[model samples]
Target: MSSPPIITSSSFSSSNPFSSLPEDVIRAHIFPRLDGCSLASVGCVTPELHSLSSDHQLWSHICHSKWPSTTTSTLTHLISSFKGGSRSFFSLSTLPPNHNIPSPSPSLSALPDQIISAVDIFYRGKCIFSKVQATETVSGWFKCSPFRIDLVGPKEAVPTPISRPSHEDTCQNLYADLELSWIVVDPTGHKAVNVSSLLPVSVERHWLSGEVHILYATVVCGHVTCSVEVTCVGGGPGGLVLHVTEACLKMEDIDGAHLNGRDSLVVLQRVLEGKRGNLCSENRKMGKVEEGRKKYLEFLERRKERREKILRREGRLDNLCVMIGSFLFVGLFYLLCFY
Candidate 1:
């Protein structure tokens, strides 16, 4: 302990350089440089350090910097390989439920809940409609004619309500011409023949009182002809009362094929007939009132004109009488002087 190990302030200062440096310089310079260098050596490091390589946000930035056009699925796959944890934590493979992207499977009956349920039906992402058949219960085999379709429903699906049919006892109106054009992509590369002003089949909804229902458009595949029939079961304004039916191309036909999983087209029709009826009724009542007001105004105008004319005529008659009386007085004075 001869020289006390030559204790010097310079050595202490060198050893504790970070203690004297500013916070920003330490974070900006030292941390990033250290982190970057550490990240570069991450793959060769221990298991704990390798797990940090799975930080998707950090890798996502790197990935975007490298392959800017990488798709979600690709990035997800790459991240999954680096990640040691379970797959559920960072799912790059699946899209958000709100994207409304259709799945390849048919077992999932309804669309994602986030999609605007009552969207104007689109076919293969096109907003136009073409001839095809849809059914309420899609069972085995059914036949349908070409037609346009539309819906008069809520912005979202609601439970079907039970109620008696507003009309008579037995008959039902199933479907109607939506007056919309149905466009189909020729997957077979055959040019689709354009039909000008084809008559649309009038379809109606069959509301079964106390039931939940939905409306869907058709996505055509292959060389199948389709048509839709709407059945209004028996529901009033407060029920889900519409039904759809579907028909497909025959099983053994590839000449015009039925492309599997073609989604339905959803068309937004004009205002509901019930609302339209109410509007018409209100318009008729308003028309009658307006007509009555016009008639009353005209009557008042005519009465005022008649009164003014009568007053004018009376004033003219009074002036004529005064002139006559003055002349008659002059004549009397002249006759009396001649006598």
Candidate 2:
């Protein structure tokens, strides 16, 4: 019988269609289609793919898409600061850092008392808006709240219901309080500026859901104040997800101010008055008593569940201690009797 020819590794290598394509073609056509997460994963497969994935152009596209408000100057500064250029900057800016490191006890004094709001607006599940704002504003009405709508600003510090003690908890809670204010961030400058401060705005409650709706104006140029409307909704599994549903911007010329001048205070006063009237009309159609009742009931249910969990854990610890004490007593009695 004649010996059969063996299929070598070289034969399989030759079959890969990607190997035949030029590096430029792969970089331009193939890499562009992959998202940031997908691109990072693909880079691990081969050295050639790794080089193409690190291209600044790919990361620049991702950064702009995620943060449309980011200016060109800010983007350039961010890229220069990071070793991996735009890729490293984008990864650090968007995602939270790894929490696995061991550390000494943190001082309570060093802990941040004021909360920062990072609002991400999504349209049909796609992120369309993102901004970071500080909660400590001159207008006490604009501060962050534990709940979606805070008609009267909170008097005392309320424990955040959504924060988890550890990552091991299977059911994760979303930080809904951070959705209250819109803060625009400059990553390169490493600063957060409140969107409301730039132009005066008012937030009104949606009749059916009690969600907040904001109407504001921003200076587009020397001539105009761009009117914008923002709406927030509770979404995702466990009703923990909070995101912006709509953000519509329309340009209107300044009325009282100079025709070719940007006067923010003047623009703010005009927008607030217009939105206030609309809020009153919407409020009349809805029943206030029903809204308050439903919100209280939901709060009680969550509080009850939390209390029951703590009691159950205490009960287990008490039983364990009792068992140990009984065994110790029995051993001492047996020794005395034997002696």
In candidate 2, list every pair of residues with a backbone clash.
132-183, 133-183
Question: Which 10-residue span in candidate 1 carries the lowest summed lDDT?
Answer: 267-276
TM-score of 1: 0.18
1-339: candidate 1 lDDT, tens digit per residue: 121122123422536553466645533443333222234344234343344444544545443332222224533343345333212111221111111122233232322211111112222223222223222323222113222233333332222222333534322221121222222212111111111111222223334442222221221222122332222333335443432223112111113233222132111110000011111222443353344334334444555676788889999999999999999999999999998
In candidate 2 the C-alpha lDDT for residue 239 amounts to 44
- On the 0 to 100 scale, the lDDT of residue 283 in model 1 is 43
Q: Per-residue lDDT for 197-267 in model 2, tens only?
A: 12123445555664545554433223343444555455545445444555433334433222311222223
The per-model lDDT (C-alpha) reads 0.30, 0.43
Badly placed stretches (over 4 Å) of model 2 are 1-14, 93-120, 125-339
What TM-score would each prediction reach against the true structure? 0.18, 0.38
